[model samples]
Target: MAPGYALALAFSVALLVTTDAGNPGLVARITQKGLDYARQQGIIVLKQKLSTLHLPDYSGSYDVGVLGNVDYDINSMVVTDLQLPSSEVTLLPNVGLKLTVSGAYIEIHGKWRVHYLFISSHGDFELKVLGISISVGLSLGSDGSGRPTISTADCSAHISDMQVHFSGGLDWLINLFDDTIASSLRDNLQKQICPLVADAIQNQLEPVLRTLPVTSNIDDVAAIDYSLTGPPIVTAENLDVQLKGEFFERSHRSPPPFSPLPLSIPDDHSLMVYFAVSEYLFNTAGFVYQSAGKLIFNVTDDMIPKDFPVRLNTSSFGKMIPQISKMYPDMLMKLKISSPSAPSLAMKPGNVTISPLLDIQAYAILPNSSLAPLFLLNLSTDAVAKLGVNSSRIVGHLELSSITIALERSDVGPFPVQILSFAVNYYISHILLPEVNDILKNGYPLPLLDHIQLSNLMLKLNEHYLLLGADVQYE
Candidate 1:
């Protein structure tokens, strides 16, 4: 709520500061061109802030020798028009940002009251401020909670011209000391410009930046944490930020057992902004779901196609494994399939893949309405993921590439495990993959400000990381 990060913080939620560059699960880069775009938007806000500048009513009593004692007060002062025709934002190497506004203009209308030798006259006056210029330096950092923080490094302002006009009063008497009155007015207005700019940055823009969401809800079951892992990295051409891109269950929020590997993205400046995402993010989702027991699926006859030639009964499986029919005669079987451990995702050049170790337990339904253990098979499979950007989310689908099945244990005597491979593969292909795809269809929200939208996206996959470059629009 206090003075914090500046315009860059709102640019795309992609701003940073100084900290040890460990392996970051997520990294955001803002190119110089991005800063250029932000500068244009910043000028509009700057003008609005300046238009609200309040100057204390000026009152003074002076003796002009021949004029005796002259008392004057300027009140009801209000800014009528303000213009910032030109401004520039420059990134300071290893420092922060420098913004300069030149050729600016302002006009103020006020009422003037003058008392000269017991003769009181009141009238309206206009003050025109011209050739105004301002310079501000802003530095970005992180707060104790890893949210970005911005503060004013330095500021300066200069006013080259000020003209005051008086009307509808004793013009002859007022003109006698017009120069003196204008000098005092100019001094009062000039001294407040830089301070007002600083106040706007500290009291106004800073609060808005602090409101930038550091974490967002993905769905009812899971939430993602995009909290800064450390301060940002400042380069001559880019401002880089690192984040802990991990997901946790909605009810149980805890860190995953695995740590992120070193992540690096190409320094391509063609795009305005870039995001580097590591596999740690997806792995954390796997960990959360696995821990919450959401990764398990129960496959029964109803889950299979009704028109399929074979059912989930022992009579159908007996054609291959005769021992099953001899022992249970005819009984419906169910497969309780689940992952043995958290699945891990691997990113490579032009590809992303995940390998899951699933445990499938076979059971037979008895007349007593209870499950009887039959066999347990371990399934290992590789799946390729196709990822795309939808609005501000990352959506993906998985395709099974290869699978291998091995018999871990059997309660109904030893039989060729390969005999059931066709059936098991069918369940994974038709049943498991479809369910996984449905979840992915909802997609995951990217680590961006809620109001920011991305377009013209280009994706590049590298070892251990994927870089997403896109142009952003701030709503």
Candidate 2:
């Protein structure tokens, strides 16, 4: 309790503190200030990572191994074989700093240990980086350049389980993966692997993130070559199309009549011609197409030169049928038509055999309804008729093979009157009974319809089309 005794006791304690090697339970306030300086370095690393990398807020736990050393002036001793357990590292609410280190472990030349870390800052990332090896060194000189950079050569680490979770929409996910999803997924995953992400953390980013695949549209859809799979093929709609083939045609005219009682059958005069087109298109009612299938001499607005030749292939029917079925599923119907045999005849007293292909176009109309509109589309072949000149007052023989008609529903709920499709085939022969004395010898006259017949044939006119159908009342 005396002043001299107290002074002596303090000196002894100080000496003991200075000499306390190989001793336990001794705590000393280091005047060296190494821990604070190390914290500043870690903070600097964080700032650089944020500003340059634009990283997302992160929170997780990590186990950091501690490596410490003791250094006084130029003399130094290295520390190793120190280990730490995993601890949580959370993002400081409202801060974006990622703290791999809450605090650091220190070893005085492999002799002593002390651990410490910070809580957090907002809008920053703080995380307990699992299995991260942390090393703290004492600087013996100014500028803190004497400490060693963390090197795998001096330490090691191992991890059992690891995972990462993030939130945001597609673009947010993009930035997380650094603007490229594939690259991001790869880099994020690689971040889990120890050395690459860890090693690159100081130099460059190598985070491998997992990515998902995408198909933007049908074009992106690729067909698998299963034996059953193929490029899409055409089917339906064009199943049954008649009236696009070779056809023999005949026309007849009647002579004048003067009898008052007016009950007389006129004589016959007819011409025979064959018609064909280069190509065909199954289209809207009477979408007449000619010119080798390319130039559409559409009957609606397209007028053909009187001599324009075109081929009408049955193939066009296949294309048209599918489209038509899609439009008129319920009301349209088709039935096949065929004749037993074609009739044979001569037009100009010469030997000629004409087998004409029959084609018909007709329409059906509902009598009374909102939809009671006219749908005049059909194809049919009439029975062969024969009349010739040698019977000379007679005409020709006519036969037909098949006919088809595709009718559309107008305002009518269903087609009201059906127009039977018909094809007419005919030829001229020498009339033996008439004695051949007339001015137009063996020469058959064109089936020129008289004014009465032409006037009697009723046809409705529209801005774009003219329709003729089944029960057309000649008005």
Candidate 3:
């Protein structure tokens, strides 16, 4: 592998490059291209190496440390008198040549630090980001092996710092919450890094003073360093705006224990159907929720009249008995409705947080949409018998292993919906407080991976998205 060989290719990133890609502008072109390349590579490396790179939580105050290694390729080069402090950072120690067609290899070699190249490490904060930060610096200079000779005054695109912040969604934030927002925030964060990267490149290459080809397309053929000025979009226009906030039990520790429910019910069961169903969803169904609370919901007045009577099912109640001895696993939650009067259902174990099994799916809608739920509900607890309005109540029981649903109508948009959510079923274990205690106590799905691989890590933008709508302000 060469020591380091980096070049810049500038497409119209919502700016105007009214100059040529000649020696005068080469510095800026190279610096910008170098920074661009470095950042892109950094993203891929970060994702591929996420398993190996561990980090500390930042929900509160905690110290973080940088512990990992990354590799890159460049021509063999060495630099002396480099001012950078970190020895790990590699930069231009050997100059590259771009020969002309006349001299076989029209190699164009110059003496200048157009873009400062060097690697340096810096401390980072979680910043309520609940993620980790990586900071690096780069510089450009001549290899120390050669004698001082008059060349171009090597300019430098000193990336004082380049960082990639990382984090897991809400589930990982706490054992109880199955926060779906975590994954959304992760994607938004990647977008936030784009502008910072663009600035880094601009700083490094603005002075290279190189000329560009005369083609109408600012996004030109592959070359080491390049520059163009036009209205077309580039990688720089992918913008994202995010507002991150979270609600968690700042106090960590198990909750006080509650006595088990009696396995009996009254003879009359009516108004208690709603609470019975709710409790069934939480305690029996092992649903994910923000906190442990009594089951609650409303039932159709006709479904159970004031004097309606029902009987409890004991024989069929033995099935679907989940181990209720674990704490609520870290998971994401969501409430979806499709109509105004339709009963709204809450789902647990977000797609991003839950285990690969225990199927749980969730989707979001706008303010006016209603909810349509499909679940084979089974409620057999003796608590349902006691939740009666008074006069009389029976332990109305329901048991179903699975419930499939079909949507009547929906107004949701093009945003992607993730249904492959599975959270560690902590509700059952949490309430039972004995069965799955071992599983929760240990914090499962332990790091079973040692290494990671990336076969086709790629980025391909469609023609429509490439048309940038912003300005480069390339001063």
**Model 3: CA > 4 A from native:** 1-291, 302-401, 404-475
Model 2: per-residue lDDT, tens digit, 1-475? Answer: 2111211111111111011111111111111122233234434443343222222322222233352221111112232222333222222222211224323221212111112242221121111123334322211111121111221222122332222222222222212322122233234423433343244443531111001001111011111000101111111211110111111111211111110111111111111111111111001101111111211111210222233231121122213333323343333222121212222221122222223222222122123311212233332322222323321011233333333344433332354232222111110111111221122122222111121011111222212111111111111
Report the lDDT tens digits of candidate 3 across residue range 1-475.
1100000000001011122121111111122333343344444333333222222222221112242222111111111111111112122323321111110000111111111124322221121232233333322222122111112222211122222222332212221121222343344333433334334334333222111122222112211111222211112312111000011122322321221121111222111111111111112111111132112222221322234221011111111211100111211223221112111122122200111112222222123443223222221211111010111111111111222333232232221121211111222222222322222222211000112111211111211111001111121
Give per-residue CA lDDT, model 1, range 1-475, as digits (tens). Answer: 1111111011111111112245777888888877787777767778888888787787888777776878888789899999999888887877778899999989989888889876999899888888989889998878776677777898888888888788878766666777787777667777887787787778866776676557777546566677787666787778887887777778977777878788666778888889988877767777776787666667788778987766888898888888887788789888887778877777788888777788999988887869988899999898787877765877777788988999999999998899888888888887666766665656667777646788889887788777889887778
Considering every candidate listed, which one attains the maximal TM-score?
A: 1
> Which whole-number lDDT from 0 to 100 does residue 414 have in model 1?
95
Superposition error at 406 for model 2 (Å): 21
For candidate 3, the lDDT comes to 0.20
Per-model lDDT: 0.76, 0.21, 0.20
- Score candidate 1 by lDDT: 0.76
Per model, state how many residue pairs clash. 4, 92, 87
> Candidate 1 — number of clashing residue pairs?
4
Ordering by lDDT: 1, 2, 3
Candidate RMSDs in order: 6.8, 42.0, 32.6
